[model samples]
Target chain A: MANVRIERLHKEFRGAGGIVHALADLTLDIADGEFISLVGPSGCGKTTALRIIAGLETPTSGRILFDGRDITRLEPRDRNIAMVFQSYALYPHMTVRQNLEYGLRKRGAPRDERARKVAAIAAMLRIEPMLDRRPLQLSGGQRQRVALGRALIRDPEVFLLDEPLSNLDAKLRVHMRAELAALHQKVRTTMVYVTHDQLEAMTLSDRIVVMNHGVMQQVGRPEEIYSRPANRFVAEFIGTPSMNMIEGQVRTEAGRPLFTGPGITVVLPRDAPQALPSSGRATLGIRPEHVSLVAPDAPGAIPARVTVSELAGPERFHFVAVEGGSIIVRTPAATVLHPGETVALGFDPDRLHLFDGTGEDAPALR
Target chain B: MPPRNAARLYPLVLLLLAFVAFPLYWMASTSLKPQTEVFRVPPTFVPETWTLRHYVELFWLTDFGLLFVNSLKVCLVSTGLALVVGSLGAYALARFRVRGKEAYGRLVLLAYMFPGALLVIPLLLLFRQLGLTNSHLGLSLAYLTFAVPFVMWVMRDFFASVPVDLEEAALIDGASRLGALWDVVLPQAVPGLIATGIFAFLFAWNEYLFALILISDESLRTLPPGMMRFVSTTDTNWGLIMAASTLATLPMALAFGLIQRYLVTGLGAGGVKG
Candidate 1:
C-alpha cells in the first residue's frame, strides 16, 4: 500500500469549445489504507483529478507522489494503480477467467499461479460459475462484480474507481457499495473513488472531497462535510433536499448585530465566525431538516406562507415562500398543514452558516 | 400477410437477382465453352460441350504461370505492407491528439478520391526513372498510393469504434502502450484488418491500367495485363479471356468466404459497451 499525494495539479483541455480548464491548482493527500471519495457534478474535474493520479492523464503542471516517490512521469503500468472504469470496460472478447488473469499473464506470472489467484478472487466475488462466460453474456451486476474482481486480482498499490457502481440498478448499487466496503476492509489498499453521487461518497469514503468546476470546495469526513461545510457550494451540494439559502445582511440595530433579509430578522450571536463585509452582502444557509416548524406566535420565529407539502413516507417536506427564495423545512408527515397556511420557520442558531461578499472576495465558511 | 407481401415482392426480387447473376453466369459458362461454341450468333446460357483445354493451353503454352505468380506476389506484398503501415497510422490518428485531425482525415480520403487514371502517366515516368518499370515492385508501389489511404481511413474509423478504456485497462495491467494495442486493440480489429486486406489485395490483383503501363516485360506482367496478351490486333479469344477472368476472381471470392462470418459480427460491435 502506498500513500498518494497530489501537489498543485493543473490540467487544461483544448477542444472545439476552446480551452477547458478541467483542473485548477488542486492538492490532496491520501493516507495509506484510506478510502477517499471525490464527489462533484459532471465536468467538475473530480474524474480529471482521479485520472491524473492514475497516470492515464498527465497534469499540465504538478507532481503526483506515491509514498514520497515522484511518479508524475510514470506510465499507468508503472504506477501500480488499478482503475475500475464506470463502464466496467471488461474486454468483450475475453472470458471472465481470462479477464481476471490478463494482468497476471502480462507480467509473465506462472500459469498455475495465475489460475490459483483467479480462482481465489472468483470465489471471493462469488463469480466462480461465471468464469467461462463472456462479458456480454453476463448481467450488468455480474459484469460489475467481474470488473471489481479484475482490479482486486492485481493487488495494486492503489485502486482508482470512476463511479464503478453507477451503472447498476439502485438496489444492486447499494449492495455493491457494501461489497466494496468489505473488499476495502479486507484488502486495506489505498483507494480514490470518483462519483457525482454525494450519497455514495458519504457512505464509502474516509474523506470526501467536494469539488465544482475544477476547484476543491471542501475536504473532510462525511459527517463533517454534512454538518460543517466549507462554503456555499458544499453546504448546498452535500445534502439531499439541499440546504436553504437566504440572501441577507448583518445589520447593526440599536448596537446589536442582526441578520436581516426580506421579512426576516434575527440577531447574530457575538461568537459567530462569519460577519458581513463592508459591502453588506451576506447569505445564511440552513439545512431543511434543521429548520423547525413552530406555531405562528412562537418566539424567534420567521413568518412564512406554506406553498406546498411533500411526503416521503413518514417524513414531510414543507416548502415555504420567504425572503428572496423559498426554503423547504422538513417535518413529520403526521403534521397537518395546508397550502397557503401561515406558519413560522425557526432556525437553530448553532446549525446556521453564513457567507460574506461575492466573487473572489466571497468567504469560504468553516 | 407474410405470404401476400412475399408474393408481391417476389417477381421484382427474382428479376433483380437474375439481372445481377447473368453476367457472372455467362462468364463462367464461357470459360467452359468449346471454341466451336464461342460465337454461335447468340450466347449459350450453359456450355453444351464442357472442356478445360483453354485453361491447359493458357497455363502451359502462354506466359500465364509467370503472370499468375507475379500477381500473387505483388498483391500479397502490397496488402501486407498496407495493413501493417495502415493499422499503425490508424491507431495513432484514432488515439492521439493529432493537430487538425479533422483536416487530416479528410486529406486521407482525398487521396482515394483522386482518380487512379490521372496518376498512371506520371507514375509510369517515375517508375521508368527509378528503374522500377517492368517490375512487380513498381506496380505494387503504385497500388499502395491508393491502397494505404483506403486501408488507413477504414481502419481508423474501425479503431475509433473500439473503446479507449479497454486499451487503458491493458496498459494499467502491466502492458506497455504498444503492448496494449497488440494484445487488446489488434485482437478486436481482426474483421477490419481482413476487410482492408481484401480491398487492397483486390485493388492490386485486378488493376489493369497501371499494370499495363508500368510493366513492359512479358515475364513480369500481372494477370490483368498478361491476360490481355491473348487479345491480338486481329482477333480476341473470348474463351481464354473468360477463363482467365474467372481465375483472377477466385482469390477475392475466397477472401470474402473467409471473412463472411466476422463481417456481420464486426458491423454489430457496438453491442457490449462494458
Candidate 2:
C-alpha cells in the first residue's frame, strides 16, 4: 500500500567492543506491493534494518519516507507499520481472537467490525479452531499462524517480518514458507522481510538484498544474484556446498590470459581480459553443480582424486583433491563415484565466475 | 525422594513443625479459656471449657477495634502505594536504556539496608518538621521507606523475565508504551505483584519500632504498639492479651491460606533477586 524510501541509514551501538556498527549508510527504495527480503548471516544487520523500518530502532542518522511523507521520527504506533517478531511474540494472556483483534481495537474499531475482521482473518489463516485458545495452548505452527494473523488483521501500510519461520521445525518451516508466499500474493502489501536463510529469501522475495558486515553486498532478483554475484562474499555465501575458489596468479600466454593455481591451470575465456586487475592475482570461483566430472584422461580437464563422496537424495557430492587444493563436485546420484577414484574436472566456460582478487571485497570479473 | 527415605525424615520435620506450631496452638487455646484457668499450677494443653468471654472483652473493654482499623488502614495504603510506585520504577529499570540506571537501582536497594532502628530517629525528626507525627498517614509513608525498595528489587527481576518481544509486539499493534504495559506486561506480572504486595503488607503489619516511635497518641496507635496497653507495670491481663493476639494473627493466616499457590511460584520464579 505504500512505497518506502530509506535514505542513508547509519546505526552504531556503543558496546564492550566499542562502537559496533549495526548498520552503515544503508539506502534502499522498496516499491509498493513488492516483497523484498534483506538476507544475511547472523549479526549482518538484516534484523537491524527491518527494525529501523518499523520505527522500533532509531538510526544514528537517516531519513525514512513513506509514500513521500517524512516519518523518520514518528512513533511506531503512529507509523502504521506491523512486525511479526522471530519469536512469534503473540500475547500469551490473550486468546487467538483477541490477539488478531488487538490492532483494530487499538485503532478504535467498532465491536461488530472487529469481530467480523477477526473471523475473516482466522478463517484465512485456518486457525478458527484456535480462536478461543491462548498462545501458550497453541502448537508452534498454530502460534506462527496467529502471529501472522495478528499482523494481517491490521491492514497496515507496511508489513515487516523478522525471520518469522525460524522457530518452527524444518518441515513446518517449509509449509509455512509456501503459505506465506501464497499470502503475499493474495494481499500484495509492501513487505520487507529479514532472514538469515538464503532459500527463504530466494523463494519468497521479489528482490533479494544480500548483506554482510552491515553493508549491502548485492541487491537483485534471485536468479541474477545466484548467476552473477557482485563480489566474493556473495559468490561464496549464496549457494549451498558453497562456490569453490582457487587462489591463483593470472598471466598472459600467447596473447590469451592463463590462470595457474597450486595444482591446476585454466585458460581464461575471451571478452573480459581487461577485467583482470593489474597485479594479475585473482580468485577463480565456480559452483559445485557447474563443475563436471569427466574421464581421467579427458581433454582440457584437470585430473583429480576423489577424497570423499556423499549421497544426498538425488545428487551425489564428491570432494575431489586437485594438485594442491580441493573442490566439491555435485553430480547426479545415478553417477556412482568412490573415494580415491581418479577423475577429471571440467569447468563450464560460460558459467565461470572470476574474481579479480581473493579478498571478500574483490569484484567479480564480468 | 524415595518413600522409605522420606519416612525417615518425618520425625525431624514433625519436631520442627511442633516447635513452630506450639505457640500458635497455645495462643488460640489460652484465648478460649476463662480467666480462672489462665494461671493454673499445671498449664492445661486444652481448655476444659471453651468460652468467648475474653473475645467479647477484647472488643468492648479496650480500643482493640480502633487499633485493628488503624493497622489495616496503614498496611493497605502502604502496600498499595509501594506496588504502584515500585512496579513502575522497576519496569523502567528493567526495560529502559537510561544511563547510570544500574547505579540508581543499587542506590534504591541501599535505602533498605538502613534498619528502622537506625532510621527511626531521623524519620521522626523529619516527620515532626512536616507535621506528620501522631497521624496514620505518616506511618504509612514510613513503611514505604523499606517497602518500596523491596518491591522494586523483587519486581525488577519479574518484569525482566517477561519477554521484551511482547511489549514490542504490542507497540507495533498500536498501543502506547503504558497501554502496552497495562494490557500485556502487568497481566504477565500478576503473580509477582501478589507476592510483592503480601511482603509489603507483612512488613507494615509487623513493624514495631517505627510505629512505636512515630505515633504517641493512644487513639492513633497500630496493633504492634497498641498491644502494649494490656501489659501494665504492676500486673498484666494475660487473658485479654492472648485473645487480642489470636485475633491479630487471624487476618494474616487467612490471607496466606488464600494465596499460598501464587506465593510459591511467584517467589521462586525470580530465582535470585539478591
Candidate 3:
C-alpha cells in the first residue's frame, strides 16, 4: 500500500567491542506492492535495516520516507508498520483470537469490526481451530500461523518480516514460504523480508539486496545477482557448493587475451570485457554447474583427480583437486565418477565470471 | 522419585515442617487457652481448656480493633504505592538504555540495606518538619523508604526475564509503549507483582520501630506497636499478645492462600515462540 525510500541510513552501537557499525550508508527504494528481500550472512546488517524501517530501531542518521512522508522519528505505533519477529513474539497470556484482535483493539476498532477481522484472518491462515488456545498450547507450526495472523490482521501500510520461517522444520518452512508468497500476492502490500537464506530471496523477492559486514554488496534481480555479482564476496556468498575460484593472471598473448594459472591455461575470447590491466593478478570464478566433466585427453580441458563425490538427490557434487587448488563440479546424479579417478574439467566460456583482483573488493571484469 | 529416596526424604521434610509449624501452633494454642492455664509450668502442649475469653477481652476491653484497622490501612496503602512505583521503576531499569544501569539497580538495593532502627530517628524528624507526625499517611510513606527499594530490587529481575520482543511486537501492532507494558508485559509479570506485593505488605505490617517512634496517637498506631501496650511495667500478659498476633497473621495467610496458584506458574509460560 506504500512505497518506502530509505535514504543513506547509518546505525552504530557502543558495545563492549567498541563502536560497532550495525548498518552503514544503506539506501534503497521499494515500490508499492513489491517484495524486496535483504539477504546476507549473520551480522550483515540486513535485520538492522528492516528494524529501522519498522521503527523498532532508530537509525543513528538517515531519513525514512513512507509514501513520500518522513517517518524517521515516529514511534512504531504511529508508523502503521507491522512486523513478524523471527521468534514469533506472541502474547502468551492471550488466546489466538485475542492476539489477532490486539492491534485492532489498540486502534479503537468497534467490537463487530474486530470480530469480523479476527474471523477473516483466522480463516485465511487456516487456524480457526486454534482460536481459543494459548501460544504455548499450540505446536510450532500453529504458533507460526498465529504470529502471521497477528501481523496480517493489522492491515498496516507495510509488512516487515524478520526471517519469519526460520523456526519451522524444513518441510513446514517450505510450505510456509509458499503460503507467504501466496499471501503477499493476495494482499499486495509493500513487504521487506530479511533473511540469510539465499534460496528464499531468490524464490520470493522481486529484488534482492546482498550485504556483508554492514555494507551493501549488490542490489539486483535474482538472476542478475546470480549471474553477475558485483564483487567476489557476493559471488561466493550467494550460491551453494560456492563458486570455484582459480587464482591466476591475465595477459595478451599473440593478440588474444590469456589466463594462466598452475596446471591451467585458457585463451580468452576476443570480445571479453577488455578493461583489465594487460597483466595482473585476477581470479576466475565459475559456478559448480558451469563446469563439465570430460575425458582427460579432450581438447582444452584441465586435468584433475576427483577427491570426493557427494550425492544430493538429483545432482552429484564432485570435489576435484587441480594443481594449485580444488574445484567443485555439480554433475547429474548418474555421472558415475569415483574418487582418485583422472578426468578433465571444462569451463563454459559464456558462464565464466572474471574478477579483476584477488581481494574481497575485486570488481567483476564485465 | 524412587520409593527408597522418597522414604529417606520424608523424615527430613517433616522435621523442617515441624520446626516451622511449631511457633504458629504455639501462637494459636496460646490464643485459645484460658488465662489461668497460660503460665502453668511445663506449659501444656495442648491447652487444658480451650476458650475464646482472651479474644473476647482483647477485642472489647482494649483498642485492638482500631489498631487492626490501622495496620490494614497502612499496609494496604504502602503495598499499593510500592507496587505502582516500584514496577514502573523496575520496568525502566530492566528495559531502558540508561547509562550505568547496573549501578542504578545496585543503588536501589543499597537504599533497602539500612536497618529500620538507624532510619527511624531521621524519618521521625523529617515527618515532624512536614507536619506528618502521628498520621497513618506519614507512616505509610515512611514504609516506602524500605519497601519500594525491596520491590524494585526483586521485581526488576522478573521484568527483565519477560522477553523484550513481546513489547516490540506490541509496539509494531499499534500499541504505545505504556500500552504495550499494560497489554503485554504486565500480564507476564503477574506472579512477580503478587510476590513483591506480599513482601511489601509484610514489611509494613510487621514494622514496629518506625511505627512506635513516628506515631504518638493511640488511634494511629499499628498492630506491632499497639500490641506492646499488653506488656505493662509490672507484668506481661502473654494471652492478649498471642491473640492479637494470631489475628494479625490471618490476612497474610489468606492472601497467600488465594494467590498460591499464581506463585506456582512463576514467570512467563510461553511469551516467546521458540
Compare the candidates by lDDT and give the number of the best one: 2
TM-score of each: 0.94, 0.97, 0.97
> By the TM-score metric, which is better: model 2 or model 3?
2
Worst lDDT 10-window in candidate 1 chain A: A357-366
Q: How big a share of the true inter-chain contacts is recovered in candidate 3?
A: 0.95
lDDT of 1 by residue, A222-318 (tens): 9999988878888888888998888877777776667888888877666675445667778878899889987778777898889999998989998
Ranking by TM-score: 2, 3, 1
Candidate 3 RMSD to the real structure: 2.1
Give the CAPRI class of candidate 3: high
- Tens digit per residue, CA lDDT, model 2, B1-274: 8999999999999999999999999999999999989998799989998999989998898999999999999999999999999999999999999999999999988987867888899999999999999999999999999999999999999999888899999999999999999999999889899999999999999999999999999989999899987999999888899999999999999999999999998998776532
Which sections of candidate 3 miss by over 4 Å? Answer: A277-279, B1-6, B264-274
Q: Residue by residue across B1-274, what tens digits does model 1's lDDT show? A: 6898889998999999999978888888898899889998776777899999888877877877788899999999889988988889889988899788879888999998899899999998888899988777778888888889988888887788888999988988889989989989998888778777887888888899998888887778889888887999999998888988888777777778878887666545523322
Q: Is candidate 1 or candidate 2 better by lDDT?
A: 2
By DockQ, the best candidate is: 2
Per-residue C-alpha lDDT of model 3 across residues A195-309, encoded as one tens digit per residue: 9999999999999999998999999999999999998999998889899998899888888878888889977778877887555888889999999987778778999999999
Q: Where does candidate 1 stray beyond 4 Å?
A: A358-361, A364-366, B1-13, B128-131, B264-274
DockQ of each: 0.80, 0.91, 0.87
